[model samples]
Target: MVTLQLRQLTVPPGHRVILHNINWQEFEAILTELGDHRATRLAYSQGTLEMRMPLPKHEVAKVIIGDLVKILLEELEIDSESFGSTTFKREDMNFGVEPDDSFYIQNHAQMIGKERIDLKVDPPPDLVIEVDVTSKTQLDAYEALQVPELWRYEAGKLQINVFQDDKYVESDISPNFPNLPIIEAIPTFVEQSRTIGRSAALRAFRNWVRDTKNI
Candidate 1:
């Protein structure tokens, strides 16, 4: 039987606590005990574990970015399978992580109608969104998982990370949105949501997409 004799540290919103020397069994047990409740996110890499609870700002960024991505996919007629904060893990690599939001685009057809995702069997998500409100995302963990693309939002700015040469390098454009300027477009619309309203902002965004893409 696996026993998790780990210390429980309660961190304030937007903050995280990291514990060292955690084994895979203990990490699995912790995840099982936590279950599907999403108030907190857990990440494990090698022998380290991190727990984070999203703040209101963090939540806002997540929703805005996720919604914009969905809009882009819809207008472009791109099929996607979203797994929001679903834990992606591989025991062999000793890595496990849950992005704020994740999606399967190029490989969406491969995961159709599936309830569970096994990283060992299925391809990793094509795009992962990270809202870095207080703590930095664990890039090493995602590297171990070999995620193709990552969008990290911090301080009202978006940074695109593309996997290349065994590392994630910051890029100005996304492979999925080669023509769209996502870095600038997303933040502008997200700010509009704050000034006008979500519905109004979304309406404007849709209009822009339709006019720009002739959709």
Candidate 2:
């Protein structure tokens, strides 16, 4: 058997490693060992642990989508607390996931001034955004954690999944932004940010929202 520390293992971007038969104790220890400052993301469920590093393009999309989401909330005068990539885990459920971006909308009041989260006591984030989630394990982790709404950006398209009946059902429109055309605007602006510049795209998005609000 080979002995390696978490620090010794290197997971390249756009790739992941899966380990099975890991228990809850080991998962917590691994999280402690890995520490909070790192580029890797982890998803653990039912003794299976998967860790991966996100690519540059993946990061770009994450930031753009997250920014647009903030803009939407601001334009609509909705109060929200943004917890970017916070690690949410629970030993009881044996589920832990670190999303690219997380926001507290419906439950913003409870999360105010809370730097950390305890899923057993604290409510799961209202909206979570991730990039290129091709694995069922990640989705399973989110469902187990009982997050109300999840946003996934992949292949230049946005997928909104709502939790119901203990499962995730894909929906065309986000429950958080029901009246707005977020399904189209989110992706359009994210892509626009890359070409026209992030600042320009953001301004355009804000203007679009204000225009829509008046109509």
Candidate 3:
């Protein structure tokens, strides 16, 4: 993790000071005050005071994951009404963090009162996906959110972590949807720049499903 440096500069008696050191806590407080502003997507972290922003790679990966989830919902006949990116916040331990993608299923979708949500609510999303483009480890974030399941796509593979007994356990495959071929083909998706639009990938997945049923 990189630490931001704040410097103080002295000026002549008659001149105005060019720079001054600002306390990290005070900086975070200013960000909190601007929470109502719609233009602000992310604020500084309370602990590190690090300014966070969504990257382009994050957006691309999110689109692919969202599309896959939509396809899965249709194939599995699951009732899902909403899907969104890292625009909502989850409050835990006096800090709020957002995941890359989140979705509500079944009756949980009925609780949404508007097109956007900013506050924490009961029963988080059924699934949360994160595109780990940053070097910072996500273990702490996962622990804080207390979400039931999380999927991370990083270094050409998909890692599924299921929350159990206040901790996350990793597995080679997703337990939430056992039949999905997300894990098997994630490497190919990561390798090809235009992989998401490849018809062969979907055809391969369909073949895998058929083979599983015949066995």
TM-score computed on alpha carbons, candidate 2? 0.96
Instruction: State which candidate, 1 or 2, has the greater TM-score.
Output: 2
The digit string of per-residue lDDT tens for model 2 on 1-215 reads 88778878899888898989899999989988888988888898899999888888888888888989999999999999999999899998888999889999999999999987999999999999988844433788898899999998888988899999999998987899888888889989988998999999999999999998777
Question: Taking the tens digit of each residue's C-alpha lDDT, what string does model 3 give over 119-177?
Answer: 45555566777776643435555566666778888866788888888888987766556
| lDDT, model 3 | 0.56
Model 1 TM: 0.94
For every model shown, the clashing-pair count is 0, 0, 0
lDDT tens digits, residues 1-215, model 1?
65544345566787887878989998998888778865888999898999888899899879988988999999989999998889999999999999999999999999889889899999999999999988899999999999999999988789999999889999999899888878898889988999998889988998888887763
- State the RMSD for candidate 2: 1.4
Model 2: which ten-residue window has the lowest total lDDT?
130-139
Off by over 4 Å in 2: 133-137
The whole-model lDDT of each prediction reads 0.89, 0.89, 0.56
**Per-model RMSD to reference:** 2.5, 1.4, 8.5
Question: Candidate 2, after superposition: displacement of residue 12 in Å?
Answer: 1.4
lDDT of 2 at 172: 87
